[model samples]
Target chain A: MTRLDMFIDRMVSQRACLDFAIAETALMGGPVFELGLGNGRTYDHLRDRVTGRPIYVFERAVASNPASTPPEDMTILGDVRETLPQAVGRFGDTASLIHADLGGHNLAKNDEFARLVSPLIAPLLAPGGLMVSSDRMYFDALEQVPLPTGAVEGRCFIYRRPTA
Target chain B: MTRLDMFIDRMVSQRACLDFAIAETALMGGPVFELGLGNGRTYDHLRDRVTGRPIYVFERAVASNPASTPPEDMTILGDVRETLPQAVGRFGDTASLIHADLGGHNLAKNDEFARLVSPLIAPLLAPGGLMVSSDRMYFDALEQVPLPTGAVEGRCFIYRRPTA
Candidate 1:
């Protein structure tokens, strides 16, 4: 498959994961988190799936489609490294679902960025909360989970902050 | 278009209306209703779309795909006129969205079925609730709404149980 095809497959997987997470979190209540808001496609899709939950988005600058951009209070700006810690402080262990789709075109740089943010994300999840992403990742307290049905294997990663 | 094409178009329109209603009700608070569970295709779609809302489904018997059938408590059996009234008694004015796609292939019969159940459904919607259906319908309390974008003009009908 071409690179573009593979990228699109990853996106489709990401969306399926979001849908699955939304359904799983419906009975279990908490807010949602969007780690990257580029174009806001995922954020908009998340809003449609997870009704009635507050969604906090983290972004470095304003580049999302105006139609999809979140309102001021819901959006947290500045470098993720700086803003995410503040978010963790404000919304500690309160997110039922979190989606991290950040970084530029450089794969190596993206890995480094996620590695840097994983720690703050750990304490931001509610018990049994779900975290989905476009990269492969693992946290000591977050147990790895299967990709939702129809999602391509290895394209998207899912984890649950276990209640136990 | 052939009969098959028209049927497919109707199904597509039904799905689009459900998606539209899900987005519309994401901000509103209440459960959802599926008036007909035939084969449970639409019910399954509603489950996927409105993950957070309880979908109480009404049906006469077990004709739907076993995989798609709702749990016993959520499924109402017997004649809708009877079962629906019982449901309305228990869930008075609590539904955020309701989809009625009952009856069989006969168009006139379907219209009769919808007309009979309209009163039963009237008192079941919360303020500003949405109701989507296959037949043209009017309730004194429900104002007709435009079909969601991309839905066939006359194939489906939309309504809102006005808050005012």
Candidate 2:
């Protein structure tokens, strides 16, 4: 598959895995975290797919379509490195799902960023919570999960915090 | 696959699903609840697969292998209907994973039992927790999950309480 095909496949796979994750962890009634605002289509999709759950959006700067922009309190602005810690202080391992779509031209930088930020995510997700991202990430506290059926590996990475 | 092959497939499939469920919810750090203790084999597998997490076994009587019988504090004896309710009062939505292998020679009776017990599982599981069972069960609070890649759907079922 071409890069474009892979990208679209990743998104479709992400939606499927997300449905599984949500069903698996729903009783937790925890907030959903979105890292990177971009066009807010994913945010919009998330809100529609999982109703009644709080979705907090973290954006370096707001550039989303006006129709898709999250409400003020739900949107966190500025550097993610700073905002994420603030979020941890407030949400603190109560987030049921977190989606980080921060992949870009800089492959090495993306890897660096993923490595740096993944550890911070552990404290923000509830046990059994899911973390989905475009780029691969690793953290001792998180466990990788298989993709949905028909989802090609390496396109979209899925991880979960063990219920332990 | 032959019935014997299918039966073996179901066990292998169950192990895979259990691993996924465990990875997804380990941070909950609650007990793993085993609903049936047939021969104590699966219970032994549960203990070996997940160390550090407490494993609670519910059996109608003590007929399990001596090596696999859970300690007194972890084993609940008597009729499941009565013991289960008591378990709910004590565990109360703290169980991260519940594996119910209550199937028997009487399919109809097993189905009846599953229907009767399905609802009781919700209060014992943490929100977003998992229920891996042999009988097909449906509850409004629990969302059914897709089976693993190679698993036959009707043989084993997975469910999760809605995060709400």
Candidate 3:
């Protein structure tokens, strides 16, 4: 088993949802770009299953935290907002899937971030490509909890660039 | 164009997502069920695309709203919470896909709904069968809105029931 498989075996949060996305993307069949690269957990889940296709990950903190990255995958260390331009230029028209799971804190700024990131990411997505990002959303349990900070919830949104 | 294609052209919400699920389910090929069949939009979308496959829909309000249902599909007009058992009794072992978009005022009740719905849906899901549901969760635009009400959000969730 690969490292990602092992990590997945122990993972506890929204595994079903994450796995579904991976399966769907693989079924679609194209180059994939992952944003946020959290501990490379999702990467480990996808690397082996996605064969022959190039998978590029833009991780802002990977350089400062090499331990978080896997030794085998094609992960780059840089801010996605800044590095995406050059990366897309290098890949030409091959990139097709852009997957982001940057957490609720990052998602809080999604609109502003999307403005900067979408233009760069949109161009990189090949015709029929998908851009998926995670956001936190209010669930009842969270609402019931009496927190020091008020609840802020969201969910993932997937946008597809028309193939025609 | 097929009957399903014609039906899809008229749907207003969740059209792309519903189309994707239906196409995926048809391509996967097996018995399928749809829970909370609001307006029967999805049923209409899949009817002709999946020829000869048994497609069941459980809807609490369908009996009252006959216009919502398509003539060719099999539909059970009853609450999913109450009728799932009987539905499962008839077709438990062969079901391969479960499509649900059960949310509006139902957001706060997801855990209860998921729990009750999972068992009935679980047994019916063929090995490797996918259970697809669209969930509503708050995001950036709704961050400032009141907790109980806001724009109805939608997110898709899929679960691949384990064969073993």
Task: State the iRMSD of every prediction, in order shown.
Answer: 17.0, 21.1, 20.7
Q: What DockQ number belongs to candidate 2?
A: 0.01
Q: Higher-TM-score candidate among 1 and 3?
A: 1
Write one digit per residue (lDDT tens) for candidate 2, span A73-125.
88888888888888888878889889898766567999999999888777898
Error of 3 at B34 (Å): 1.6
- What ranges in model 1 sit over 4 Å off? B1-164
DockQ of each: 0.01, 0.01, 0.01
Number of the top candidate by TM-score? 1
Worst 10 residues of 3 chain A by lDDT: A141-150
lDDT of 1 by residue, A32-71 (tens): 9998888777877877677889998898897976657899
**CA error at residue A12 for candidate 3, angstroms:** 37
lDDT of 2 at A93: 87
Best by lDDT: 1
* RMSD versus native structure for model 2: 21.7
Q: Write down the RMSD of all candidates, one decimal each.
A: 19.4, 21.7, 20.6
Of the two candidates 1 and 2, the one with more favorable TM-score, higher being better, is 1
Q: What share of the true interface contacts does each candidate keep?
A: 0.00, 0.00, 0.00
lDDT of 3 by residue, A1-164 (tens): 22222222223222333444455555565678877776555565555455666777788777323423545457677778678888867775556566766543333576566655666766676665555555422221111111111111223354556667
